[model samples]
Target chain A: MTGVTISGVGITPFESDAERSALELATAASEDALDDAACSLEAVDSVHVGNVLTEALDVQGGLANAFVSAVGLEGVRADRIENTSASGASATHRGVEAVASGASDVAVVVGVEKMSDADTSTVTDAISKLTHGREYVQGITLPSFGGLAAGAYLDRYDAPREALAEVAVKNHENAVDNDIAQFQKEVSVEDALDSPVVADPLRLYDCCPMTDGAAAVVLERESDAEGVHVRSIGSATGTHAVAERPDPIEIESVSRASERTFADANLSRNDVDVACIHDAFTVLELLELEEIGFFERGTAWEATMRGETARDGAFPVNPGGGLKARGHPLGATGLSQVVELVWQLRGDLRGDRQVAGAETGFAVNVAGFGNNSVCTLLEAP
Target chain B: MTRGTRDADGLRVDEAFRCGDCENEWYYTRNRCPDCQSATFSTYRLREGELVAYTTVNVTPPDVRSANVLGLAAFGDVRLIAQMSDDDPEVGDSVRFAGQYELREGGEKRARLTGVDGDG
Candidate 1:
């Protein structure tokens, strides 16, 4: 199979700015990407945008085209890809496939979400719908879902509650060096421990905040590219409903996707120079590390607290601050990870948090808890 | 189990047949009946399973309870999600179906599963 290469990528600093619409944010990110690639909108062949709750946000339809038109790429063929929180990565995957299959010489992918415009309850309700419709009607929101997984992980592994706080502190400390991070200020483990509880075993600090942002990437065939090569891309799905899962900590989708990606790239976890796994919640990062075969079962939290995933540690995870601090704008998060990976692989990161000598990178994007997952591998050519 | 039959609501229902010819239990939503595959089947009350997982839906759907609990049980090799009985359920609890409940103002009718009498 032909390889796909990412020529350039860009992301907006996550913040609460009601003045800018979702399309505007998307266009800005796309412009940055096109600038980095030394190309104009007229040079692009196709566009793929990722969005969630655009209809709920009263955007009606034509959101994908709206992004293209706003970016002055009116003649480009465009479509939208929505897979809940993983929408961004899913859209990136589609754009990659388009380039790999020779469907388009240059494909542009953008992921944007404007959730702050919606009321808190409405946004929570819309996000909750990502779960089983029937199950969500009962009272299961994302926090509670994470809480359940936390409870199970705590009981099964006897993991200390303090370990979760440590995860938060590590990510926040890493974010301190990230200028664009939403929560760049460092927080102590004590601060995390003292924070009010949103759900049992999950404090306010343990969860990612609601964010609005955009990320974009420019992809081309390997023969046509000038930067990092997309070594492999793998995606898989699991039971949509949390109640249907056999074990919340052992998400089959992530495990399968990571395995497929590694196999396709002919690499293992040991071959990876750096990684950025989804960390929507603290426990999620731990579980994902184990699921992606980084740490053994029941040892992720322990490894994390021991500084295993620290920026300067042996295996740095989420060097871009993760969703915990980098901001999880839902639809934009997956592509944002890609942007960070590109910077790391190119040795262009201008911060104290850059991963040193990151030659090969892996990223995992998970949607709706453990329902839908995708893993992509990239190597500097 | 019979292959084609419509329920009162016009929803298609099928029965799983066990042996070609024998008195066996027919199952709904199964590939084959446990007792007789005579291809003949009938719907019967399915009971016996522990709630392996559950989630309470905060979002209300029609007339359903605002905090309705959804439970998943592993009966034999098949695992399915079912509505919880009257009592609140936790993960790894046991539950059984009682009877059908009225649908919320324009929602599909559902059966209620109650906590069983044994310790889970």
Candidate 2:
């Protein structure tokens, strides 16, 4: 196992109507995390901020230094990491390295995104531009990729369309128990099917909403303190052009990262009790599960349809509602997933939502529709 | 026709590069071959391909048309992402590069594909 231990975690509510600036949100989450770890500002040796689109949308820069001053931390190393949607996990990787290498005694990583004030068109345009320049000019958005992949997957496997909607239905139900979820309410299969179509064969419910939030975690060398151990983190990058892949449904980034992570940690799939997958779209949840070796190719959809991934199922997935329900604030989503897993491993979750005997948790955060991905494994102390 | 000096937008919609070392072809222009790391390349134009997958996008960016259709087409060993001039193209259908059109506001004219009749 890695020498890094997660001492504390904190997350602000995921909301669409953000009333606070990104700096304020980040400061608040950092304060909560430091408080949880009983870590004083003077003890933090480094701070890494995971953020994207804030400077573009809010026209603000030096976010790391800004957060350092806001939290009253001085003489600590600080910087920002940007990797599209996987920025949080990348920052966490840096934090873990700092402590694992004895560069710092304690490190705090905060990821924040505030885009509620921006107009919908501006946000959509910015996100769409994440694709390759050629594809962007062709007007291909992330949801379009989801729709294309979903259609191909269904036709190739002869899977029922209801399987896709079932993912949305289940995630929405899970969100009902998640107070911090953006859409903390249940949605029926019929409701999902009837929802407005954003991309063909993928309804509005199939996609994650644009959210504003921040999540933070404090890391230190493994100690006797009550915390979760950072087992390992694996990352990989695939073809930049989505169309260039030989197989449209194959997410090389997820599979490669998962393989490396499991192998590096000397762990097996059976060891993971719960998972927080990047379900930016419902189709992605099934695709990633298969890619991660949790289920066979062309079979995760059926498993999902049979309720095998529910909170009470043998293999629980997205126990914290997932991005489809919890919300996706781009940069903050990866760290939020870790926060959820940390809480689950620590048995901090309330009734019904907690995995009864959860000791190991897995999380995968993807960037730019699987152009790159970072997989994280956390174990109970 | 090979015009190595032309910019992406100025080049033909079907324009692409082939590595001299590995013969790897791709749509995006790169100084060196991604597969063989060869600096030598030749330009080529793709006129036909097979539709691999497609989607009808209803929630589009502000600059794009509503209900814009996009598709991934396979040309020999290469793949290209382009707009679909026709909405009813099926996967595996033989498609031809129809031409180019402005798919987004303030964007360069990009390629468009259409299903060729009598070809699956």
lDDT of 1: 0.77
Can you write out model 1's per-residue Cα lDDT over A1-381, one digit (the tens) per residue?
A: 238888988888887554688888898899999888887777899999988888867764889877777777767779999988899999988998888888889999999988897877778867766655444433457776776677679878988899898888988888887777888888998999898776556788989988889999999877776978899898999866664465656788999999998998888899888888888889899999999989999999999988989998989998888999988888899998899889889998765667888999999998988789989999976
Q: Estimate each model's TM-score.
A: 0.84, 0.96
User: Could you give candidate 1's per-residue lDDT for residues B30-113 as a string of tens digits?
Assistant: 345544445555444456667665545444433446555555566544455545655456666666656555424344455555
Q: Which segments of candidate 2 are over 4 A away from where they belong?
A: B1-9, B106-110, B118-120
True contacts kept of each: 0.08, 0.78
Task: Write candidate 2's Cα lDDT for A164-202 as tens digits.
Answer: 999988888888988789999999999999999998899
Indicate the worst ten consecutive residues by lDDT in candidate 2 chain B. B1-10
Query: What 10-residue stretch in candidate 2 chain A is worst by lDDT?
Result: A128-137
TM-score of 1: 0.84
